[model samples]
Target: MKKIFCFLLILSLSAFGFYPSVSSASEKSQQEVKEAKQYVQKHVPILKNEFKKLSRSSSLEDIESLIEKHFKEYPAPQSLKSNKISVFDAFPEKQHKYEKFSGKSLNLNNLLNDIKTSSTGDVFTFESKDNTVKVLLGEFGDINILEQKSISNPSVSKAKTTKATGIQRQTGIGYGTYGTKLYTLWCEGNFSYNGKTVKVISKDGDYHKHPSGSILTLDPRGLGKERDASIGKYKYKEVFSRLRVEGVLGFKWGEWIYKARTVETYIGSTVDGNIYGGLKSYK
Candidate 1:
């Protein structure tokens, strides 16, 4: 009896066309994929050279000097230069305390080992004696240096606090085909913190005035939640202000294909002894 009921439910869903078939509708083509792979292969050698230099450094001053020289030769991104966001603070770390090598001499072997085992998009941090100096490394090979003075430590306030409020936006761009004719797809919208409140900003680039089948959707990350808290002596207000882009291609039979990517930028500040804003992963 249970099997019959389950079968009937699946049949009803199929009749309604709830599931669409997957196809070779990805935004990137085979050639583009090959080029991307080749780029990574060429970039690995440069990364290894830099890592060797960093690993051989005898002291924190040497590491700082090397980073400064490298930055002067190849400037950092505008966003990173202007914001000075510690890569360490921007993302969460697998380990909290640097207890393993707390008082010992600085060793990057553990960090290197962690990076070898970590997948892309993973973030890791290693600190020197007394947490005076920090090295933030992303699995994708981006690295940053942070000093103790740059880290924020806000004091707690006695007054009650209200939930954080902010706005978010998303933009998408990709291509699709309608029968034999090709079309470019694009969309953008502004939404409230929780993503429940939405306002379509634009939906241009579509050639068809009234296409046979079309669909656009938004998927919000780290938005609309009650994530306010207070520690022993510090009151922190966390906010996640970033942009996520998702592109879609539609077929004549009401089938759709999607490709999504996120561009995250976290800007934080402290004022009047209270932490007004902070990193997305900070608690």
Candidate 2:
């Protein structure tokens, strides 16, 4: 009797379309999937595209050009923009099986030396110029080029100021909801600190976003001025030019953070929506 009752209950649920399904893909659905795959192929040309190999006969210019070409083709996400290439060994040193580029500076001269000499299986890592996406080239002399094409965006690249400066692109991330990119900008400008006007250059990514924010107690004092001043927004143009940043303020413990305080803006550069971190506070 109990089994009969259970069977009836299941039958009732099935009638309401609650049973498991193993439906075949419809013709339209199949076409949509094919189209999606094609779009994905278009989205990331770096991985599918084949790179020309370097040879002993390759010149310094030739090698540089080849690597630059590959970097150009591989699209980087925003976070990985404006960064230098970092070099490392492709594998553990087995009696110095590979000659790694361990030069300290990211200067172009060192890069050329590393590339001109590194043998097969050596690795060179660097962020792409535009998107700052990481490029890990295996076998530097005879290289294997690779870039990011994953679902997540490219990571933030640590790079010095490029000719291109400023921050912009304030838009809504979702329907009926506006989104703002919260971050710090480095600028050399005149600002008022504790009631005195001063000109200074604050570190990058410390342009506090608000007049009031989370506890400064956690943040080490003296990095920049702490304030209750209204930190403002960066216009779209500002992001592209006025704002000097390596990347966006990303996840902190899996949560999005948009905290700010009075920070620095370039002296004499009046930008909308920012509380400049004035001259470094010193004892």
TM per model?
Answer: 0.26, 0.19
Write down the RMSD of candidate 2 (Cα, Å): 24.0
Off by over 4 Å in 1: 1-39, 55-117, 121-236, 246-258, 261-283
Relative to the unseen true structure, what is the C-alpha lDDT of residue 276 in candidate 2, on a scale of 0 to 100? 16
Cα lDDT tens digits for candidate 1, 201-249 = 2111111211212332333443422223435454332333332333342
Q: List the residue pairs that clash in candidate 1.
A: 193-224, 194-224
Q: By how many angstroms RMSD does model 1 differ from the true structure?
A: 20.4
- Model 2 CA deviation exceeding 4 Å by range: 1-109, 112-114, 120-136, 140-202, 205-283
lDDT of each: 0.25, 0.21
Best by lDDT: 1
Please write out the lDDT profile of model 2 over residues 159-263, one tens digit for every residue.
Answer: 421111122111100000001112223222122222222122222223343211111212322222222232344211111112211112111100011112121
Q: Cα lDDT for residue 148, model 2?
A: 15
RMSD after CA superposition, every candidate? 20.4, 24.0
> Ten-residue segment with the worst summed lDDT in candidate 2?
5-14
